[model samples]
Target: MRQDELWGEDTTQRYDTPGTGMFAPDVVEPAVHRLAELADGGRALEFAIGTGRIAVPLARHGVPVTGIELSQPMIAQLRSKTDEATIPVVVGDMATASAPGPFHLVYLVFNTISNLLTQPEQVECFRNAARHLIPGGRFVIELHVPDLRKLPPGQHAVVFTSGPGYLGVDTYDPLHQHLTSHHFHYTEDGQARLARSPHRYIWPAELDLMGQLAGFELESRHADWKGGEFTAESGSHVSVYRLGPVTAT
Candidate 1:
């Protein structure tokens, strides 16, 4: 499905999990705190700011926040919580969208960058982030490390999430760095539904190279929002890259 269709109205309605899963205070507060600190009292921009999950709370924390979102349905959901005056959002692709000037922080969380589904688009996303940031500003990305190790020699899929009412699996194309996450949701009535989305999984080293191509220097990488050490066993990372002089040719 296309990106917008994947996050259409039905999906948008189901996206917000207030006080649970990604919306739990423990999962969210630390990220908001860290982002506020990184903003350093300057304006912030969020790429793919879905349903104001972080932007609303962060704005409440006194940092000015703007967003770039492609899904109109998602943006509408966001509007239900806050007005455009409180947090203005431009509707366009994050890889090419333009928002108001020179934000101190530009962030893409929850592996949103991977939605671009191609190397060049991902590179453009880095450049786009750089374009929106002031020199010395920071670009932050939170993404998962591919779980190739979980696959047996010939297996191409891994079950990444399994819970009482849900099952999530990822099928991989190693040669193309592609992934399609399939989610199965079960209703109390015994009904089952499936949703799938495509992504291009990226490695830390390749991400750093993308940053460098957009004139950014690696600042720090942590296992989580709380600044935990990123060890080999870490499944995901929150990476910070600082804007520097443009050198991409």
Candidate 2:
């Protein structure tokens, strides 16, 4: 795979297709709705706020936003939104950037934490968010819980009988605990365009331990804000943390 062809840069163009709102209205709306209430109506920061999907809407909800994003094309895609140009952005890696100002909330949505491939980077991301958070502020993350044990070898793609022609290619290496997924969207012309994303999957409990390592306390957690308990079968994990006072060196 060519380096440029993979999912490293310009995530906005990749994830922000026009009329994409209707693609997963049920899942996206609930997630956004939950985030809005937790925002605290104060200075809020979004790590990897791609194309302003949730950020734009949260801004519309009358909250100020500071975005830390790595890709310029992703930042450009945010401005491409209706009335989203005013949202301030800092173009840098969220794991190491001085995100500026003491924020009441710093959030990473859509499992964006996995974008950082290594465990060290993910830990630093937590520390960075803590560095920018105000006293008693919160750090929020909505991440996917990987079901690796369910996948078996010799499986590349399977067409579901329910027929949107769902094909799932599971690419995971047990040695590294990395998941590289290849999603193929079939066109009417019998061609397919692949959206291959590589992610480092981590369990929810393990991430909580990571937060502890970064001076954050697990404040609250839910399976979903629609009122569900987190279980092994849960598809997603929505977590919240309260940052401890800045540690002295």
Candidate 3:
């Protein structure tokens, strides 16, 4: 699906169900804390800043925040939360859009980089982040690791989440490093609504290479926003790359 099409009116509205998965306090706090600290009292820019989810709170914490978003619906949803003076957003592609910045930190969270859907586009996103940062500034990304391990011999699909209200599954295409997520939302009337989005699953090492190509070096990587050690068993990672000479991993 095109990036803009993936997040329409209903989808953006459904994204912020307070206390649910992504919007839960516990899920949001650690991320804000980590990003705020990384900002080091400097400005921050968020790529694909959907609904101002992380940006608004980070700004309230005193970090100047700006965003680049491709979806007007998502941006509208964000606007509904806070006025333009609070969080200015540019409606354009994260991989190519420019926001006023030499920001100290630039971040893409919640597996948003995958939305680029191709290796070259994802690499361009890294370059774009580098473009917005000051020397030695950091770029952080929160992405899920591919779960090929869960794909048995010939299976191409994995149901990662299943509940009475929702079902989330991913279908993989290893030949092209693509994965399509299908989300099913159930209503009280026994009707199921579906939303599907495509992503390009990337390996951690591959991401590091993209950082290098964009003139960045790996600074640190963690299993989550809380800074847990990243390991083979981890499902997602928060990786920080700096705009300078390579750092020993």
Candidate 4:
């Protein structure tokens, strides 16, 4: 998949758009419901709000949410849903785009920031988020903790040929320090789309440093907000940051 096409037109979809294969089965319902609750209302902004998975429900719950997306098709698909037609959708790169207003909470969930490729850009994204929030506001990031050293040197591609042409492909460039994987499902239906989210993985320590460089103070890190301590070798991470020192009232 080309870099531009992968996240742009490929992802803007619905449940039938790909389902659990494209999205992890744990995406919605309790997990996403809990994620929405973290915002706690008051002009929330979600980065890379593809298809309104959490945004729609949060808005319905009266959160007054706004979304920033790079793909117009994704935004169109989001608005196509009756629930999100009226919600604001800003189309631009998340690293530089400004949201509609100062938000109490700015969340970039589903490991969206890893799409930026460079560490500097990721830090810049955090800074932009800081510039968009009120004092004491939050910038929340959710991602899976990556284990790269475990993999062999520059391991590029994991092919599981369980069935005919049903192979999984996970590639990495140790030299470039980036990893992205693609999974393909083939059937009589002809090369169907499964779950394919290719991200430039970063460890929790690296990401936390990026946030700090962007002028944020680490607030908390959880394995999951439902109450899980963030220890080494964890799978998922929910990192919260205080934007900046409060301006005196």
List TM-scores for all candidates, in order.
Answer: 0.96, 0.85, 0.97, 0.83
Worst 10 residues of 1 by lDDT: 240-249
Give lDDT tens digits, candidate 2, residues 87-122: 888878889977668888899977889877889989
lDDT of 4 by residue, 135-223 (tens): 87889888877666456755666553356756676677666657766667677878576766556778788887887787888887888
Q: Candidate 3 on 1-249: residue-level lDDT in tens?
A: 577888988788788877778888899999999999999999999999999889989999999999999999999888888999988999899999999988999999999999888899999999999999999999999999999998988999999899889999999999999999999999999998989989999999999999999999999999999999999999999999999985656
Model 1 accuracy (lDDT, Cα)? 0.94
- Give me the overall lDDT of model 2: 0.75
Candidate 1 segments exceeding 4 Å error: 245-249
What local distance difference test score does each model get?
A: 0.94, 0.75, 0.93, 0.73
Query: Model 3, 167: alpha-carbon shift in Å?
Result: 1.4
Candidate 4 ranges with C-alpha deviation above 4 Å: 1-4, 8-26, 83-85, 159-166, 189-198, 245-249
Superposed Cα deviation of residue 98, candidate 3 (Å) = 0.7
Per-candidate alpha-carbon RMSD to the true structure: 2.6, 4.2, 1.1, 4.1
| lDDT for 73 (candidate 2) | 69
Residue-pair clashes per prediction, in order, are: 0, 0, 0, 2
Ranking by lDDT: 1, 3, 2, 4
